[model samples]
Target: MTTLEKKGSDGGGSSSQEAAARRGPAGPGRFMGGQGTEKSKDFKGSGKRMLGLLKRERPLLIGVLSLGTFSVAASVAGPKLLGDATNLIVEGSLGKAFAGYSSKAEAVAAQHGKGKGKVADLLSSVDFVPGHGMDYSAIGTVLLWVLVVYLVALVFGVFQGRLAALAINRAVFRLRQDVEAKLSRLPLSYFDKQPRGEVLSRVTNDIDNIGQSMQQTLGQVVNSLLTIVGVLAMMFWISPLLALIALASVPVSVVVAAKMGKRAQPQFIAQWKTTGKLNAHIEEMYTGHALVKVFGRQKEAAEIFRQENEALYASSFKAQFISGIIQPAMMLVGNINYVLVAVVGGLRVASGALSIGDVQAFIQYSRQFSQPLSQVASMANLVQSGVASAERVFELLDAPEQTADPVTPERPDELHGRVAFEDVSFRYDPEKPLIDGLSLKVEPGHTVAIVGPTGAGKTTMVNLLMRFYEVSGGRITLDGVDISAMTREELRSGIGMVLQDTWLFGGTIADNIAYGADGATREQVIEAARAAHVDRFVRTLPDGYDTVLDDEGTGVSAGEKQLITIARAFLAQPSILVLDEATSSVDTRTEVLIQRAMARLRSGRTSFVIAHRLSTIRDADVILVMENGSIVEQGNHDELIAAQGAYHRLYQAQFAQAVAEVD
Candidate 1:
């Protein structure tokens, strides 16, 4: 038996054996394996393109930058002003304490009279006079000015945050819209090759990451850069020697940050990739939970989940741990510089080369200088992750899109449903050709049934006819007009399809039925439902036609969902119809009803029916039996059965199986 058949049959196997089969011996790696953590080779180019997304909001960006600059400037100046106030207080207090001595010294010097002796020198040295006790008013005035500067800085900081938020939100909004539009332009094969969860991650998770990074990092980047420059200048103005000592630690901090960033980047990339894989696995498991339970593979599924979760945890922890070290490492360097400046500035003050207040301001500037450097280092990781996300989003935008028609061509005013494949050939891969130079023609209002074993390319033929995929070597025409000549929208407007896998969005039953016919009236939807034999079942529901369905149409049975899709196609009322195993999911009674409904739906349309149940298509005008992507037998039921070819053997086998089941 095949792996799937064995899984279905095994009910009481050893846990290990069942798990090995369900999850494969490779564990979760088989499901989680793919391109892992794609790092951008051209980071600068990606960063430029990422920034280009914000170009439309240049005015907002400029406003944010302006406000941020004002805030940093005020912040830088506040410390100096406070230092000045400190100086005033110190000088006033000292002068007040020496006031009496000054008066005594002047009197002694006058009494000595002779200008040459030790007493004269001592009196000169003791020259002191009493003055006003302290300048409390001047100190208060300076303090008041300092308060105003800080308050202004706070207000400007708020404005900068608001403006940056607006700009980032608007830019991200535009980016999301572009990605949505790009999805529609991409070829169907692109989706076939990619996981739905991975694609969704790009649209939701990746885009949000970019937005958050911008909002958090943009304002800080502006403030940090300005603070660094302003503080460095202030430090040099106070004491060039101390400034050089402070600047000495920057290169060491930079080297440490660079090394950590390099280590953390790949971890972050892996974190996001594994995050996508985990989501994909969860989606798959939840979607097939019923099957998993039916086969008693719940243990296996949980084990698989545990494995994937572990992988995600490992990557996430490494990424956070590596990036987390940058801040502390930078602060370590900053503290070393802080101590050096304090020691050196104190000595200089004792030597009278620098005043106490000037040394205090220099220390404040040194601390300020280290803060922005640390902030910038931390911002580096956030920016790196954002750039990685941007690269993914850009990769989606840069994927190969379906070719556009060279010129706009007008579609026929009315379609007659005549389709001809003139030597059509196609292959998913150029190296392995599937269909080779096949030709066929069908007149209007004829029904063609296609039957074959699995992998016979039955669905592929339908895809080609619908132009979901283009022919590689030949032309397919609709009513004597080449399909490629018209736009995809115009070409597909005349055809309707109903597949075995029914799809329904989250909405009321009436809305889903009316989806195919834009601006269709309520009465028209009911009429189409009746024609597809869905009106009876819908009327049985509590809300009737207004009943809401979930995304997966969970409340309804599979057969019911299939009927609703048929109703949708019926409402479309196209000139050509394609049905691929439309009744495969229904019971015998429902299948009969659906076959009758389908017959009515195909009354005046050219129809192609792909059915595994050969009994349903015995009355078709022609039955084409395909094998290995080419027609091997073609005739009506009686003719093909008498010929005793592939069709006869297929019919005979099915007949024997049915008889055996009855027995």
Candidate 2:
């Protein structure tokens, strides 16, 4: 049984003490300094790569840009048209006040009557207003045209938004698909060093951040930029002096935003890093909740979690606080510009150099100009965050993949299960070799038992055989063919493994049993379950073979889950079988049943049994004792006992322990 099972069954010390013993010292906060703390180094490169992803939908992007341009143009034209209507109304009203004329025609009529005008006198007198000089009809016509322009602008804006949204969604969809594909190609070594939660955050959180930024930032970026330019042109057309005064604030706002963005970028990077770290901690705590509770270490766990949470809060606050300064800073500059324009334009209007309507239009254009600038300034945080996330995603995409075979070789019609490891040397670290110059062979239909203490490199041998990790210095061959030459799928198809840690997906019992054998009939599944003795317990369940297993097979005991995996391997019917501590979790009776089933299952195939319980492999054809990184002794159980070697000592010790327990 595992340490956790022993601790829970025996009732250990206080939960905090148990947790501390299992976890050891905190290691000077090492968790905060590793891969979890890594930040994006090349923001520009990542941003460029992110933008490059959209190139695939160039036509859609072009359509979006064109629509955005037209929409902005129409919207800008509305203010200018409104200005023209205001100017006409003001001019007509002023005429009536100064000259007692209701319209231009009335003024012309009086002049013509005095003989200052010739033949046009009769027409002017007939068209003149009675009391006021203002022509309400002309002003109403101009206002109606302004309303039509505003309505058209609103329609274009709506269509532009729709098209932009569609384009962004399509681009983001393709981006997600590409990231998903990249994940499958990554090597196991990539996952081995990184925390699973951190990797998950990159896949789910980081990608989502990029998508959200694209959705809010893309269309607004294009529209805001266009609006700024269009608004500037209108301002210049109205009055150069006022335009100059408004433009003065542009440089100040730009400088302020640039400095603020620079300060905020590092904070944003730190924020994401801390966020990933916190997620990793939470995932770890959740997965090991049972162990924590069993040990009564909830307080310790909560303390550690609180520390991580505070770190995340600190980083997030700094990032947001720094970025927050941009808006108000830009607003202050905009307000100052507005005040200057009002004062200057007021002077020009009084001197008759500019009309009230032109002043009003210029003021509106100034606000429009400042609005886009403010938006762009505020968007700096989002863009930085997006780029940071993109960089992380790109890092995964750029990781080296497992080497592939140069050629796809055809599988032989028959595999005899003859295996050899020739002068093999392997190591996880280059400076320290774990398996050195090891040579071993197994004949067809022979059983080889491997017995070793923890870290004896026993599992490493199986790993090499299965090609989970390649041999460092030598080759492993199966049926006279180098295993590496064959495709991984083709080579692994003929080998069935039952690991100590049983893995069963969420599915019906029958479905899991049939997992190894595609297109397997119900009869085949039943036969395999019977062979593994899984049918004995499965039949007692309410739904029998149709019963659903939760993820991780939580509803079943460890022993039952192991039996299901055995049944799955049986259904595969591979040429070779490997049982690594297959009965480690079961009771004595269950182990007996499993041993019998495993024996039957291994009858005609070459088998490798890795066992800690010496009694389980006593009847094996040969037994190998491993110590450190090398095999020290090899023989059948009786032979090894007679020889009084390392195997004899191990078997004797276990036998004595079992006898003492019984006594």
Q: What C-alpha lDDT values do all the predictions have?
A: 0.81, 0.79
What TM-score against the true fold does each predicted structure earn? 0.90, 0.88
Candidate 1 ranges with C-alpha deviation above 4 Å? 1-40, 101-130
Worst 10 contiguous positions by lDDT, candidate 1: 1-10
lDDT (tens digit, per residue) of candidate 1 on 1-663: 000000110111122243345434534455455334445566789889988999999999999989988999999998899888777765565457545545655544554665544443433332234453567888899899999999999999999999999999999999999999999889766765566777888899999999998888989989999999989888888899999999999899999999998888877777777777677678878888999899888887787778778877887788788888999999999999999999999877765577667888999999999999999998877887888788888999999998886486867667998889899898766676777787888889999998988767787787787766788988898889888888887887888888877788899999888888888999999999998888999999999999999978978998898888888988998888888888888889878877898898899899999888998998888898988778899988999999999999999999999999999
Instruction: Mark the 10 consecutive residues where model 2 has the least summed lDDT.
Output: 1-10
lDDT of 1 at 341: 97
Top of the candidates by TM-score: 1
Pull out the clashing pairs in model 1. Answer: 102-128, 102-129, 103-128
The alpha-carbon lDDT assigned to residue 324 of candidate 1 equals 88
What's the distance in Å from true for residue 165, model 1? 0.6
For residues 1-663, write the lDDT of model 2, one tens digit per residue: 000001010011122343444444543353353323334698788989999878877887787788888888888987888887777676565555536555556666576677765333322323234355677788888788778877776787777778777877787788788778877666544555566678888888988898888888988999999898889888989999999999999999999999998888777787777777678767877878898899888887777667677777777777788898998999999999999999999877755577778898998898898999999999988998888788888888888877775476745557999989899988765766778887888888999999977778777788778776678888888888888887777787888888787778889999989988889999999999998888988999999999999866877899898888888888988888888887887889878987888888789899999898998999899898988668898889888999998988888788899899999
